[model samples]
Target: MLSVRDLWRRHRRKVFISVGVLGSGYLLYKLYGAHRRRLDALERELAIQRESEELMKVQLSQIMQAHFENIQTISDVMTLPHAMHNLSCRVAEELDLSQLLERLLQGKGQPSTLTQSEKLNLWERLKILSFTRMALSVWATTMLSLYTKVQVNILGRHLYIDTARRFESSSTTESGDLVDKEDQQKFLGTVDFLCQHGMPPLISDMEAATQEALKGKQLSHFFNSTALHETIMQILIIFMSQGSPHSWIKYVMPEDSATSRIDDPAPSDVTEFEQLMTEARAVLLSAEFGSILEICMKVVVNAVVEQMGAKFRGGSIAMGLPLARVLPQVAQMCPLLLEEPSKNQFIRIIKCIPEVEPFFTRLYANMPSAY
Candidate 1:
């Protein structure tokens, strides 16, 4: 009887302990629920604030754009001194160009003066952006100066080339790949932005502004100069990256042809690249851009090669020539480059390249078409 009573008491004690633990857990769960609800509420509020901030940014941009437009309309066509005075008044009235450009690009009210960190960040972005993005940005900047009747200067051109060189230097991988995965995404994003927000504006509105500005400044031949030529070459480097298998260029200049033997069977990637060239050529031919592209190409294929020969003095004479393809390959890709005297001249130049000539000679030996 004593043993039975002891067992019963122990069982009763155990039951009380179980109940106590369950009660504590229940209270803790209720407290957790209350805290979770508060956290969720805070997150919702934060999201709402972000949306409001973006809305305000959009509104501010619209207002500033109109303000600049008005300044341009009122100031342009005025005599140089009068124009200068009007711009000065606008500046004094709190419409500084740098500050306005800051608002345009960053949604900030600060001046366009860049901190070292900001410049480093901008340089990082330059590695991935296409020439189109760079060009559009340049165009916007030029327009802003023009709108304010500011003088055209070498500062813009110098910065552009320096950035491009730095970008190109950093663009290549240790393994000789031109672009990596991260760069591809950035490049695609830049292209997307250019097509969506950039080109349309430049083609429609900014084009007129550019022409008027150049004409007004009596620099109508500005676009035809070495400034634009060098810019075009830098832009072409973006495409050159596509030609390499290990580079992101293959993806951008993707191959999209069916496989076969001799007819279209020049490797899948090569076929794809050739197709891209064909499509691009057709577009260039059909558009007004053709004339400019033609001029740029003439400058590039001829003068660029000569410049490279001068710059790189070591045993590898072609070291400076990044787009140094075999003459046969370039011709196959774009036959327009093979037109008569130019083609003959290009062949002569290729033959004279010390580092490249031996390989070209061997190629010519095996394939008559290489000649």
Candidate 2:
């Protein structure tokens, strides 16, 4: 139907179109194959690298732990200057203590020679940790000093009072309810970490530091400084957060039932009361209290009130004029703090104590001016 030239032109066009389709198909196939090959190679390389990294981590952990033990052995009885110098050398040479501590806590650092069962002896476990912390303290001081200083000046100063307000505001919410979910989780996570991995190490560190300070005649000096009070209050706040709903103080200071509940011999003097109030006030001003308020208000404040009331009822306070005066002040600040029947209970319990009745009567009479 077509002329020779036209037919030939049409045939060339078809041939060219076929060639282009084939070329495109071939190119696509090659690209797909290359992509698959790259994926396979990448996966294999990643597997190998991960295995190598894991092995290295294990080896490094073991080596570092060995170094720790060796250093501990050498420095345990060494003079303070010598010990501190040795620790500094280790920090400079081995690894930053912060990194080391992070790895150690994650269980990715050195493998312990002791089995899980073998490491349960509280005292022995503490000794080992104390040795490590003593070395790490210097590093901690260097690393955290700047950060804590800023926090103390800026955030820390307002933390306790702010926390109390926050806790009061948050009482209506559910356990995990927060506008910022991530923050809530982070706080809960920190509580868990302290409960599981932190407390023993902390107690160990404190005990060790106390012993060392005593040896150096630094206890009075340390006590006089706000630093020690802040630290203790923080620990106590952590404990309060993790404590049971019922009796946090009871758990901490178990009742000695042998003593009479009625009279209890009127606590001789007020030294114990003074000591306790000092501790409580210090705790009330720490970051821990702020954190507690941030997490939950009704729960913590109620707990604090209950515990404080228990101290009054459970013979923790005695006949000291200073204590009587201070007790009224604390009551004024916290102000029958717990909600509902619990708050009534706090007031009622104290009222029932014959020895404390006169103080409360005066406290109640003078309440208007006190605040």
Reference-based lDDT, each prediction? 0.35, 0.35
Error of 2 at 164 (Å): 44
Question: Any idea how many clashes model 2 has?
Answer: 2
What candidate 2 gets wrong by more than 4 Å, as runs, is: 1-8, 77-371
RMSD of each: 29.5, 29.3
Query: For residues 83-165, what per-residue lDDT tens digits would candidate 1 score against the true structure?
Result: 22332232233211333334335623443656656754443232222223322233222222221221111112222333345
What are the TM-scores, per candidate, against the unseen true structure? 0.24, 0.23
C-alpha RMSD of candidate 2 = 29.3
lDDT of 2: 0.35
**C-alpha positional error of residue 239 in candidate 1 after TM-score superposition, expressed in Å:** 43
Tell me the lDDT of model 2 at 123: 26
